[model samples]
Target: MNLFRLDASILPTTSTSAEIADTVEAEWAAAHPGATVTRRHLGTDPLPADAWALAATGGFAPEQDRTEAQREALGLATELAGELERADAVVLAVPLYNYGVSQHFKTWADLVIAAAGPTASLLKDTPTVLVTTLGGGYGPGTPREGWDHSTPYMERILRDAWQADLTVIKRELTLAGTNPAMAALRDLADEQHLRALTAARTAGRALAG
Candidate 1:
């Protein structure tokens, strides 16, 4: 089996989403000792910003008439799609930044979609796990309820567009103790983190089976 893990947190080591994903990956590794694991650090090595645009427009031109930049974009899209096609399962650790989606992730997604083209449905049915972290509470009943715009976009793209068999694990209130405004919610944050980590491990084991 092969696992393709994509980490989109700029703070690599200190990222809660990545840490939780580590738990899931650990369980996956334990279940499949010899399984191959591919890692893509989108935060540190984001795809070219212009790649998507070049790809989108290049499709209308003949390959031989494409500019060098367009050729590179098409090549990148092909590579990105190939990674997903090769993986038995996919794990994505993406964090909400400034109440918005990560541009790096969006670029990757765009490239993949471009590569898939008319046969996009071919990307369906794969088991995919998405781990997301929010600095503040955004769930129902919270003061900022309905304020999360990242999760819904991710779900629409991954589950609705790609049609992957998706499983999402979220950890909210991450800045409770660190941020003065949320100091009183420290305990809730800790509890949420623990639950999220436990769920991540459980999901990994189930996927391995």
Candidate 2:
């Protein structure tokens, strides 16, 4: 089995999303033993911001008439799409930044669409897990209840657009322990953290099984 793991955490060491993804990956690793795990760290090595535009425009141009840059961009787009097609499973650890998906993830998604076409289900029926975390609460009645604009968009892409057999794991209020203003929420944050961790292990086992 081959697993494709994508991480968009700028702060890898302290990323709550990554912490959960690690558990899922660990279980997959243990189950597969010698199976392959392809990894991409978009935060540290972001894709060229212009690649998606180049790839999209290049598609309209004849192959022989495509510019060198266009050719390279298309190649990268193809590779990104191919990764999804080749994987038996997928893990995407994405966090909310400014209440939306980060640029790294946006670029990656654009590239994939550039290669696979907007309607293509590259991960059709593939078991995929998306781990997303937020620093503040966004549940009903919370001040930011509707402010979270990341998770739903990704759900549209991964579950609806990509057609993956997707599972989502989420955690919020991650800053309660460190942010002075959120001190009152520390206890609740702790509870949420443990629940997220437990959910991670369960998701991992399900992925492996």
Candidate 3:
């Protein structure tokens, strides 16, 4: 089994999303024993700015004058596609920034989804897990619930474009002083996320077998 892990949390150390992803990866490795996992860290080295510009234009740049920037942009897209094609399962660890997925994560999604084939065909039927860490608490019934677009948008993109069966695990209220009673919520959330990843790994291994 091959697991593709994408980490898009900007924070280097105290990032809850990254910590959860680490736990998930560890759990996945433990469950699969011999399975291989490839990790892509988008926060450490962001995709070239030109990639964003080219994606916005929806056109490939001319080859004769193709600067390194242009090549890097295209390379990012190709690399992402290649990884997706080779993996049996995908895990995305992202932090909600202003009610949306981090820019790096969005860029990665755009590159993968831009392929010409049917969204589902290009992505195959890989199982996907989305883990998001938010600064404040907000759910389906909260007044500011509409601000929670990260999970919903991710679900729609993966399901519509890749026909992926996605499971979402959200960790909310990470801010300094949002809810006093929920002080230890982050650790609990991490435990739950680890379990989810373990399940995904088991399912992937069974399918491979």
Candidate 4:
């Protein structure tokens, strides 16, 4: 079995999403001993800003007529799609940035779409776990309810577009103890954190199966 894991946290060591993903990956590794893992660290090595656009344009052009830039972009798309096509499972460690998806993650998604072409379903039926973290709470009944623009978009792209067997694990209130405004909710944050970690472990085991 092969696993494709993408990490989109800017802060490698200080990232909760990465930590949760680590647990999930560990479980997957345990379940499938000797399984190969393909890692892409998008946080530290972002995709080229124009890769998606170039790739999209190249798709409509003849192979011989494509520009060097377009060729490069298409090559990247091909590589990224190849990784997904080979993986039995996928893990995405994403942290909400500015209340929305991280730019790096979004760019990678664009490349996937371009690489897969219009009719090819490269990720169809693949099991995928999304480990998402939010510094602030956005659950229903919270003051910032409906403020999270990332999760829904992810659902649309990963589950709807890619047709993957998807499971989402969210860790919220990440800034409660550290942010002055959220100090009062520190206890609640800790509780939520523990729950999230437990869920991560559970999710990891699921991946292995």
Instruction: Please report the candidate that would top lDDT against the real structure.
Output: 2
Q: Write the per-residue lDDT of candidate 3 for residues 87-143, one digit (tens) a residue.
A: 877777888999887788787777665433334454557767777888876877766
Per-model lDDT? 0.89, 0.94, 0.69, 0.91
Q: Which pairs clash (backbone N, Cα, C closer than 3 Å) in model 2?
A: none
lDDT of 1 by residue, 1-209 (tens): 99999999999878999998998899989988988999999999988889999998887799889999988899999998888888888899999988878989999988988878844753488888899999998988988898888999998888888887889999999988789989899999999999998899888987686
Candidates in order, TM-scores: namely: 0.96, 0.98, 0.76, 0.96
How would you encode candidate 2's per-residue C-alpha lDDT over 127-148 as one tens digit per residue?
9999999999999999889999
TM-score of 3: 0.76
lDDT head-to-head 1 vs 3, winner: 1
Model 1 TM-score (2 dp): 0.96
* TM-score of decoy 2: 0.98
Order by lDDT, highest first:
2, 4, 1, 3
Off by over 4 Å in 4: none
Residues 42-118, candidate 4, lDDT per residue (tens digit)? 99999999999999999999999999999999999999989999989999999999999999999898998898965
lDDT of 2 at 68: 100
Error of 3 at 164 (Å): 1.6
What stretches of model 1 exceed 4 Å from their correct place?
A: none
Candidate 2 weakest ten by summed lDDT? 200-209
